[model samples]
Target: MPAWRRIRSLRVRWLVATLAAMAVALVLAGLFLHSLFQDQVMRQHESALTLQLDQLTARLEFDASGQASIDPATLSDPRWGKPYSGLYWQLDEVGAAPESQGAQRSRSLWDDRLHPEPDSPADGQIHVHQGTGPRGVPLLLVERTVFSAETPARHWRLVVAGDLTEVGDASARFARVLTLSLLALGVLLALAALAQVAVGLAPLRALQRALTDLREGRSQRLQGAFPAEVQPLIDDFNGVLDRNAEVVERARTQAGNLAHALKTPLAVLDQAAAPSVTADPAALAALVHEQVTLARRHIDWHLKRARVAAAQRLPGHRTPLAPVVDGLLRVLARVHDARHLDLGADDMPADWAFAGEEQDLQEMLGNLMDNACLWARTRVHVAAQREGDRLVITVEDDGPGIAPEQRQAVLARGVRLDEATPGSGLGLAIVADLAALYEGSLSLDDAPSGGLRARISLPATR
Candidate 1:
């Protein structure tokens, strides 16, 4: 392909290249137009020469024996008939008809002279030719046959001439103006292309800044502030962020629980050790084994949570908050058997999905609702809503609520306040950590039914 054609085929470089090309086209068009203009002017100048020849031919007359006559003083032009100003004429006699009247013009007979050849009977035709005229003035000539009406056999030649200095000068002046106009247009086009390049590529810069913000954790996901062309990219980027944050949070929570779980056995070992420098190595060994077991269970629970949330890692894996809430309540109904828990919701978008790993969603909801079910003696109330930028899930129970003084401690990692309950306090902590992972928050408040209200808020999916 040609270089210009190749430039147009590219994505990023086409605009500038096309503008530059149009400028080039303008120049070429100007050149062609100038040629057309000059050609028209030249044709008009030649037509005038032909008309002068015809006028001169009309004055022809025959003598008694049929001999051609002349009238040289009749050749006239208002603007160009001045002496030695390049317009001139000639007349002559030949055996039959002159081959060219141009050769018969007499003003520049042997000097910088030229005359047109008049037509004849056998090869009779008017002829125009270019040559130097009197005083070396560049000129054109028109020639034609001048026949006598009285005697058909007796005809002469007539010629007309013109100078081209004035035409050339005028053409040059017009050409200069035309050339300057084309150049100005080319310059303007170039500037316009530069502005277009900046304007067209602005979205790329915005995308770069948005990606940078995501990397620095200034934003949890790519949001609404983006150009339409780059909107899909921003959305995909947000999906990736959602998945990766879940992965990283799961890993951290597992690591933390592993560390927290080892505390009990180590403490027991410290207390049961024999009084020796080795501190009852067998007892210490047993304690270490128990701690390792506890760490293993904690790791297992975290792994399950991670798995449940992993659905969010896949593209378009968003789970609706309402369905999860409803499912949890159905399970609550079954577990309680004779008891009842009301799961009421209104104005929830039916297809509203949570932007999270599926397992993480399951784990958070499962723990919150299961805990609510266990404590809800008369009824468990569950509801969810989209609050500003969050998917808010509130699980409430009609049972006794935790004391305000102990609420903060209960939320602490592995700080189980209910010793009588057959479970770990990792559930609330895990839920809280998952909320933190999504740049969301969680809180505890009094429920309308005189129970504990667990409010879990996750970032709303785009």
Candidate 2:
């Protein structure tokens, strides 16, 4: 499918939009939380360094010569005496003192010193910064300038630094855990969104199934409870169906009434024109008879067309194939008892129904059976079965069969293969017309009994 079409679907669009929103929310939240945690960790680490700087300043001692010294045993943390232990302090003399004048360090400094910016600080002022410790390790450095309590003229720069690698590791660990936690949350929320979409659209699916049933003549209208959002549409659709059925019924009534109105006058005219009683000119009598016959044929054709137009599209009309065929066979057997033809129908399942009017089904089956009885020398066989959504019916006779080339011509109005056969030649044509009206088909083929076979395919119930 095209990307646009996929997005056009309501379910897909809902899922994509919701998940996109969720993903963006999770990403932003993760970033904000990571930054917050990192800042808090850094502040706590810097606080510890400041406390250490205070301790270093408190232990500082200076002589009148501006020299400073510190005893290793005075420090409380053992790392103060351990060389390159990542926690260290240093003291340097300021103002007129030689660069190497009063350089004293904690034992942890070993042979290296912390290199901070060369900026002087006011007396009793404290500064914090990032600097490099011994061996190029990253450090958080806190420095203060203080005059010795014993000698007011002696000033010393006191500095303390702590390793920053632990803070970095903690921040990195927090980021990884936060990303995983947020991703898991996204997955769970995505599933919830999908389930919500399915539940929300369930009514539309039910409506679709109901429409299918209505179209296939399975049920008359939409049924079952629906959400308020969709209930109005269902009610409106059912109203349209009702109006459609009403219109079709009205048309059928008009067509039947018109048929009766026209047929009565035509019948009277046909009887009046008959030559059984009065002997008018023979030529005039024959002319009147021919015209009356033509008029009658025209009337029948038009009336049948009108009836078919009205009947074919009416939904929710089903007639069982078995009962219709059985009833026809019973009537045909009695009607053709003199011929002593072996006429019977193969059993059809009760569920096989014609998705059309019962009268139409009777007309179709009655015509086909009557034609078969006329042709069959001994037996006529009728059978019906379902093929997919179609009902397939076959009527065969064990008599002289129609040639393949002539079969198509025989279905035309007023066409007959044998003129001697007493029929209006419109039976097959009417059957064909009604079948076409119902969107069905009829074909003639050779029967297995070496006779004619008539097969019809029509819509069937589910």
Candidate 3:
């Protein structure tokens, strides 16, 4: 894949997105902080100049002629006495002729006069401006108009000009420091984002490793502790693995059972066909027919098991208990009409449905109800109800019941309790195996009517 397409990894995507957002935030924050710092620095500088203007105004002495003069020595700052020392003060008469000089200036101005931008200020109010100072140095000027009663017809403008080189240097240094600080912060935040993405996705990494182990046959199922957010997915995958393993085991067992079951019938057929075992033709034919029937029964039993096993995992399968039970009861009532057995189903909710193939449910219930009808004297009752996510079905008969110890044996293949009981002894076994394939169970218990009770639990669906 191309490099851009390769960016589909979640870790890379999260890191890139987080770092980009942090970068933008840090850049904006840096700009805002720098602007605040510059404003504060300029305000402090202007305040200092305003204080100088106030002191210069305070020292002004006007003769009775309204000529403004100031003694430079009275100023506390020594820079006022040095020429071009980056700090200076001057006085100008308001509305004076452009060529006339009626004011005294600080010696720091030397032979150059402070020609600030023309602006009018109210008396005692300071107005700041930017202008060129001695030697063309950039300057911040704080100017204020003063009115003295000693010269009622005239107002004096006192100005303090300071060089901006120092402020410029300070601002530049601040910008450099702020840039470095934000860059460092961005780097640190990026690292933290990377770490967070790694920590958050660690469970997925562990899951990948577990899948690798399972694929390589190192483990039977996905096995590990994960975060709560990911544990459900892990559990579901493990469940799938468990079910697959069970299917494989069931297939192997069915093959073995089928082979073992057909062995006796096939051996008998082979003996009847042997040359030294010649017998009457009719007897031999009957023997072959019986053996073939037994073999076919075993085959059919294994085929049914395989079919149920395959359909057990299918989704969205629903068979209502009411209809299947009612249908089976009606069919059995006629099949056992000679005995006049009362075959009937109890009233069950129509919504009580099995979570499996309808045919499999029919097969299981058919075997159970038929076996009940065979043992029933006059009454066989089928009952079904929902218990949580399971459907419980019971088949009861009012006849001679087997001892508790023998009930289990009756559910084993070909383990007939009585040879006189006309059956292949596979009915109860098939029902038990079918129930097991659907992750259900079958048990033989005592009925309320003093007969056998066969109860089966199957998965239910709403």
The number of the candidate with the highest TM-score is 3
Task: Assess candidate 3 and give its lDDT.
Answer: 0.87
Candidate 3 lDDT over residue span 150-247, tens digit each: 77789888888999999989999999999999999888888889889989998899999999999999998888889998989988988888888888
The residue-by-residue lDDT of candidate 2 on 333-416, one tens digit each, is: 999999999998887988889998888899999999999999999999998877899999999999999999999999997798
Best-fitting candidate, scored by lDDT: 3
Report the number of backbone clashes for model 3: 0
Q: For each candidate, how many residue pairs have backbone atoms clashing (under 3 Å)?
A: 20, 0, 0
Pitting candidate 1 against candidate 3, the one with the higher lDDT is 3
- Displacement of the residue 412 alpha carbon in candidate 1, Å: 1.4
Model 1 stretches with alpha carbons more than 4 Å out:
1-30, 33-37, 40-44, 47-70, 73-159, 163-290, 300-315, 338-349
Q: Give residue 62's lDDT in candidate 3 (0 to 100).
A: 81
Cα RMSD of predicted structure 3: 3.8
Worst 10 residues of 1 by lDDT: 115-124
lDDT tens per residue, model 1, 97-193 = 3353344454434433454433353324677778777777788877766555576766565666888898898899889999998889878977777
lDDT of the candidates, in the order given: 0.70, 0.85, 0.87
User: Predictions ranked by TM-score, top down?
Assistant: 3, 1, 2
Kindly indicate the candidate among 1 and 3 with the higher TM-score.
Answer: 3
